[model samples]
Target: MENAYKEIEKGYLNMELLRFTTAGSVDDGKSTLIGRLLYDSKAIFEDQMEAIERASVGKGEEEVNLALLTDGLKAEREQGITIDVAYRYFATPKRKFIIADTPGHVQYTRNMVTGASTANAALILIDARNGVIEQTKRHSFIASLLQIPHLIICINKMDLVEFKQERYEEIKKEFSKFAPKLAIKDIRFLPISAKLGDNVVDKSKNTPWYEGPTLMYLLENLHIGGDNNFLDARFPVQYVVRPQSDKYHDFRGYAGRISSGVFKTGDEVKVYPSGFTSKVKGIHFGDKALKQAFPPQSVTITLEDDIDISRGDIIIKKNDTPKIEQDIDLMVCWFNERPLQIRGKYAVKHTTNDVRCMIKDIEYKIDVNSLEKDYDDKVVKMNDICRISIRTTKSLYFDPYTRNRETGSLVLIDESTNETVAAGMII
Candidate 1:
């Protein structure tokens, strides 16, 4: 038992985390694929399995409905559709995973965007019978827009199509024809039957022609170490840490998560807005002092000079500073039911910075289905993706969304209701 515990602890320490989102049209086997992936990998508990089995029996299912594992909402189970985003967590010996199961309906595009915004990889399931549909294209486009590093196109429900290689090739070819238009870095195609447990967690005997790695193997082995931008160092100050203790009386540290790049001790850094320059005195992670800090690390950094740094201020390397702009162009996904009013003011939040912004102009609305720009349609409604210009009250330290996602994204909130109205990516 002690040996097993040691192995578990080692696995926990060595495992890398992977965040992925699943998207497809309604009735596609996304939930089932995740359910199968969890079940076959022994990630699900015995009690959970029993509960799922009982739910299946109560629903009069002939066999256990794997889809029930992710479709947790009553409305989702009753309507036999996903209405909102459902997140699931599981771990294997090699890696840990957080699965964002997004809704498939066209009306839930905002929900999909919210779930997929932070994902490193996107699993776009294409039903074998339907081939490449509108939703597939929409999701694929969003994945590209959001700069998801990896895209795995899973042609699900191969059992219904006799697991034919010809069908799979046809879909792959069709998708590849238009894929060049998008800016996706890595894209892979896979054939699988989510319901029958084929090519999900295990290799399937049905597909003798398919020689690619199984979905589980591909996910586990995919190289994601280089996904983050380490070239342009960006650190947004979240809080100013000033403890009122005797031992740490002189300690003044800036606490924030490293957005990108690297900051090492004695590195010359420039503070945004103020344009104040200082040297990085030390990088601390809790009680231990780190030699350097990189992307996604939440650490406190003390500087050599006492600069007036506050929340919303960014610390960047002197040579690699980002754009300081008040007027910004963005590709925004409108999330509110109320239409966007031109010249109307909205509270804009980017990183740790909060500022008010006025809509300058509606550049054009994107027809997600046809991938065309509708310049005539200035009325931005719910689920409408459009490019617009906005002028902020204060200058923002930002990079293009394609370059660094952490520093490139912002959201507009309705001041009256204090609800998020739109999500935007800086252009």
Candidate 2:
């Protein structure tokens, strides 16, 4: 048993990771779909399956409820609804997956944003009997707003509609009509029965008219290498590493994660806010030196020349730099209970830098359901998304969210309470 456990752990460490989020209306089978995926892939432990079986029987269920696998919280199981974001990890031979099962209610829109913010792909489930509804549009709009690279519209509960091709076509057509308005780069439609395990992992024999790959197959084969911004190099220094040792007495290295693009040894780089130039002497992961570092890599970099670089400083290729400005425009998603006050002073955190900012103007609040700009309403409350302009105490170096997600995002915090009030994407 010990040897087998070690082998399984080794295999997981070698697999590539894919993060995805699911959104759907109540009882649309979002949890069940994820449960089905895990079960069919043989990712669940036997003990977990046994526990779910017991719970189902206790609830007087006729069949083992796969949704019970993800709905772990007592409230969620008792109410038959997901409130908070439930994250589950599973792996197949080809890849590992991080599933963010977000709540479907409109009130929990903030939860969906929190889950999908870092996802590479989003699964928007639509009930076959209901076709496309307001919740569908709301979730679809949120997925597009987050700039997720891929979107999969799963027409779930196909068995309920007798697996009819006509119903699938109807929902597909309705979704296609509104998709052009969104900023989604790639989109695909799949007819699935999460309850009966049709097309969740293996291809369903019932859908002869369908020719596309199953959800599992698409997830495994999807090209995600190009999803990150590889052209723009942005490294936000998180800490300054200076070891107090005899062997490395004069060593000064900047420690941080490469948010995007590439950084190589001996490359000429410029520091933001300071405008000082330096050359990369070496990149070290620890004791070993790395020739290059790319997106999402954490390393310590030694510079050729000593410069006044700090935690908030950003290192980038001199020629290709982000716009530095005190005045900024962004789409803000309000997270706190209190409504956003115009000209309100709040702390703004961009990358590794922190500064205070005031709301200069509220351009318009977005009606997510209708995708309309509510110019008349400027009061921003919880779960409200709006376009707004702000003025910061210092210059912020950033790109549009569409250009680079890592460098283009920020959050606002209420200083008095130190609670994060809103999330923003540069526009």
Candidate 3:
């Protein structure tokens, strides 16, 4: 009992926030599953629960509609669906979490790609009756394309299917066959009823024949320790902090978030594009100096020499540097009203780096439903994922999105309208 309190207190006091995302076909109970997690884990306050209950009553639901807890926007409430990526925050005794409830519409594939890009794991829900549909493959393909390490295929609304073991196994067999073609490492399937609160937070008595940890158990115990690259140090300077007056005129610092690995004081690092060399003099998270900084943390770095570093420039270990290339191949999910031009220019934003790029060649288009490649349809339209070659004006220093998402991904913006046209994962 004391240990439980300690764990709860520690989580309430200081818990490391872990971010994850959920993607599935529309009305697959993604929001309900999340609501069940938060509600059953005791993450919701009384007032919040009251509000949810009140909203559910207003919506003419007999019981509190758990999906109402997440569908907070007016459009989503009216439509009874999620439109964009809705970010929800909650905490448990084990971890602090942020769940991005992404849309499943074909037109909203871009939103799923965006949400999955930074997620440690992708919780993919499958309706027991629907089995593996086209949207399921599309979501799974996106998770694989984004290189999400862990995948939880929650077979939801099992009660509707009579909680049949054969049906569950059949779905498992189907998904297993398709998973080998994906680039995922860990995969698990759970038969859950988000509506009845079975095997989501609590074990389901209806499925006494099945034996496995509840969905909550997996979420709490999943190993996310190696999610970030700890060996290759890369930091992109976002801002330069310069306090120029008679008081501290000599002060010059490079401010940015560490993309990967660990950077320590006095470490020898190279400034990109310029080939200039410098040693880290100090690390500042805020006002104080730290000995080192690590991934996903924002900080300011003061170097030993003022070597003409600017925003969008990367700092890395002198020996372990990423390749700088002008021509590259990337898997892109086209998301826009306008089609991609065969040979057109775009503003490519990758991490903190941005450059002008043009389509050099169309490699192939991937069929999400069938996993087939169509080479003849070179025309890129909305929600069609295709691999293509692009040539950037300046060399982009990066790696495969599979190696490092922060350095390996790029988003294309229309040059004329300044609208985000597509999201790409470098191959």
Q: Residue by residue across 1-427, what tens digits does model 3's lDDT show?
A: 9998987676677656678889864488877788778877777789988998998898788987777777778988898877788888877767788898887887788889889888888998999998988888888988999898889999999999999999999999999988889999899899999888889888999999779999888887888888898888999889999988898699898999988889999999999989899999999987788999998889999899978988999999889989799999999998898999989999999878889999999999998878899999888898899999999999998878889888888999998999999998898
Tell me model 1's lDDT, rounded to 2 decimals: 0.92
Which stretches of model 1 miss by more than 4 angstroms?
A: none
Give the poorly placed runs of model 2, Cα more than 4 Å off.
1-14
* Residues forming the 10-long window of minimal summed lDDT in candidate 1: 23-32
The RMSD of every model to the true structure, in order and in angstroms, is: 1.3, 2.3, 2.5
* Ordered list by lDDT, greatest first: 1, 2, 3
TM-score list, all predictions: 0.97, 0.95, 0.93
- Scored against the true structure, residue 11 in model 2 reaches a CA lDDT of 78
lDDT (10s digit) by residue, model 1, range 92-136: 889899998888777988988998899989999999999999999
Score residue 341 of candidate 3 by CA lDDT. Answer: 96
Q: Considering every candidate listed, which one attains the maximal TM-score?
A: 1
TM-score, ranked from best to worst: 1, 2, 3
lDDT, each prediction? 0.92, 0.91, 0.88
Give the lDDT of residue 392 in candidate 1: 97
- TM-score head-to-head 2 vs 3, winner: 2
Model 3, residue 343: C-alpha shift (Å): 1.1
